[model samples]
Target: MVVVGGGQAGLAAGYHLRRQGLDFAVLDADPAPGGSWQHMWDSLHLFSPPEHSSLPGRLMPVQPGETYPDAGHVVDYLSDYEKRYDLPVQHGTRVDAVRRDGDSLVVEADTGTWRARAVISATGRWSRPFLPAVPGRSVFTGRQLHTVNYRCPADFADQRVIVVGGGNSGAQIAADLALDGNVDVTWVTQRPPRFLADDIDGRALFDVANARRRALEDGRSDTGGVASLGDIVAVPPVRAARDAGLLYAKPMFARLTADGVRWVDGSQSGADAVIWCTGFRPALAHLVPLNLRGPRGHIPTDGTRALSEPRLHLLGYGDWTGPASATLIGVGRPARDAAREIAQLR
Candidate 1:
C-alpha cells in the first residue's frame, strides 16, 4: 500500500498502517518532514491545547510551560513523530498520478512509481487555496493575497486592507492585521461570524463532533448544536481582537474596483490590498484521471473508503471525507478506520 501525503492525516494513517504491520510507504511532496505547518505564518498557533492536538499513538511532547504549541512546534512534533515511529515516509516525492493496473494501483511520481495493492490519498488542501471570483478582480490594481501566502501583518501597515471569509483563518488574519494599529482593516463574510465562547476551545468542539459522529454511527439521532471547525476558537489573538472591538465583520462585497471594493448597497471603499482569508479546495487533481471525483470535485467516500473505487481511500480533505478529518486531533479516527479497512481488504 502507498499513502500519498505526509501531513497530519497522512501521518495518522501511517501510524495505523504501521501498527497493523502493513507493508506501506508514505509519500510526501515536501522536501522536509514538517509538511504544511512549516509554511504557516510565524506566530500561527494551534487553536486547541497540546493535549487535544496530538496525533494517534504518540502524545505531543509539551514545552516547559506551554499549553498551546505554535506552528514551528507542530512541525517539530510531526517530524519527530515520523522519526519515532520509523514510518517509511519518502519526503520530496510528489505523486504525479494514481492509476489502476490490473488488481494493483500504480503510483506515479516525480521520483519514481510504486505499484501498491491499495492507495490512501491523504493529501490535504493546503496546496489548493480557494479565492472567490468577484467582478473586476482582474482590473484590481492592488495586491491580492490568500491566507496561504499571507505571513506577518507588518507588511500591510498603513494600508487599507479587506480580509474576506468567515472561517478561523479569516478571523485570525483579520485580528492579526487589526492589531497593527497602522493598518485599516475590514472583514467580509458571507454570514455573521460565530465565535465559540471563551471557554469552548477546539478540544470541546472536537469532543462534541466526535460524540455526534459516534451517536450517528450507532444509529442514534443527534439533536445537538455541535460546532463546526470553522467556528472561531477564541485564540489569544482573536480574543484580544474581540475585546478591543476589532472583531467586526461585514457582508461580502459585490465586486472589486481598481483601488478597492464596491459593496452590494452601492457603497464603495478604497483599499490598498485584499487579504483573502478564503479557504481551500481539496487538492485532488492528481486523482482526476481515476474519474472518481463527483460534483464540486469531491470524491465521495464511505468512512474514508472511496464509494466508486473501493481500493482507493481519501482522508482529511474535510467533513465530506470525514467529520473534522481536516484537523490534527480529528484525523486519527478516520485514518485508523481507513487503515483497518485496507488491512481487512488485503
Candidate 2:
C-alpha cells in the first residue's frame, strides 16, 4: 500500500494503516513533515482549540497564551506526531502519476515507481489556489495576489487594499489587515458575509456534522450542519474586527479597473492592491492518467474508495469523501475506515 501526501490527512491514514499492520510508504512532495500547514499565512489559526484540532492517536499540545493554535503551532504538532508514530514517510518524493499495472497499481514519482495493491491519495487542496476570472482583471495595474501568496499583514501596510471572497480566509485576512490600522482595507463579497454565532467553533460544527450524518444514515429528516449556522466562524481576530466595525463587507465589484475596481452600482474605489482570499481546488493532477475524473473534476468515490477503481482511494478532498474529512479532527474516522477496508482486501 502507498499513501500520497504527508499532511494531516496522510498522517492520519498512516496511523490507521500502522494499526492494520500493513506495509506502506507515505510519499510526501515536501521535504519535511509539517505539510501545507507550514506554508499558511503567519497569523492563521485553527478554528478550534488544540484538543479538538488533533490527529488520530495524539492530542495536539496547547500553546501557552493561545486559545486557538496558530499555523506555526500546528506545524510543530504535525512534525511531532510524525516522529511519535514512526510512520514510514518518504519526504521529497513527488508522485507524478498512478497507473494500473496488471493486478496492482504503479505509483510513479520522482524517486521511482512503487507497486502497491492499493493507493490512497490525500494530497489536499493547498497547492491549487483558485482565483475567479473577473472582467479587466488583467488590466489592473496594482499588485494582485491570492491567499497562497499572502504571508503577513505588514506586507500591505499603509496601502489601500481590496480583499475578495466571503469565506474564512477573506474574513481572517481582512481582519489581519484591519488590525494594522495603517492599511486601508475594503472587504468585497458575492453576498453579505454570514458570520456564525460567537459561541460556535469547530467542535460544535463537528458535532452538528456528525448529527446530520446520523440522521441521514437512519433515514430521518436531514438536519443541517455548519452551513445552516453560517459561513464564517467568529475567530478572535475576526470578532475583534467585527466589534471595531472594521469587518464591514461591500458587494462584490462588477469589474476591475486600471487603478482599482468598479462596483455593480456604478461606484468605484481606487486601491493599491487586491488580495483574493478565494478557496482552492483539490490537487489531483497526478491522478489524471487514471481517467477517473467526472464532469465536476472529481474522482467519484464510495466513502473513500474510488467508485471506478477499487484499488484507488481518495481521501481528504472534502465532505464528499468523508464527513469533514478535510479537517484535522474530522479526518480520523474516514482514514480508519479506509485503512480497514484496504486491510480486508489483503
**What TM-scores do the predictions have?**
0.96, 0.98
lDDT of each: 0.89, 0.94
Model 1 alpha-carbon drift over 4 Å, by segment: 222-225, 228-230
lDDT of 1 at 134: 76
The local lDDT score (0 to 100) that residue 77 gets in candidate 1 is: 94
All-Cα superposition RMSD per candidate:
1.6, 0.9
Candidate 2, residue 232: how far the Cα is off, in Å: 0.3
lDDT of 2 at 189: 95
Model 2 misplacement above 4 A: none
- Per-residue C-alpha lDDT of model 1 across residues 59-155, encoded as one tens digit per residue: 8878556677899899999999999999999999999999988998899999999999999999899999998777888999999999999899888
What pairs collide in candidate 1? none
* Count of clashes, each model: 0, 0
Worst 10 residues of 1 by lDDT: 222-231
**Residue pairs in clash, model 2:** none
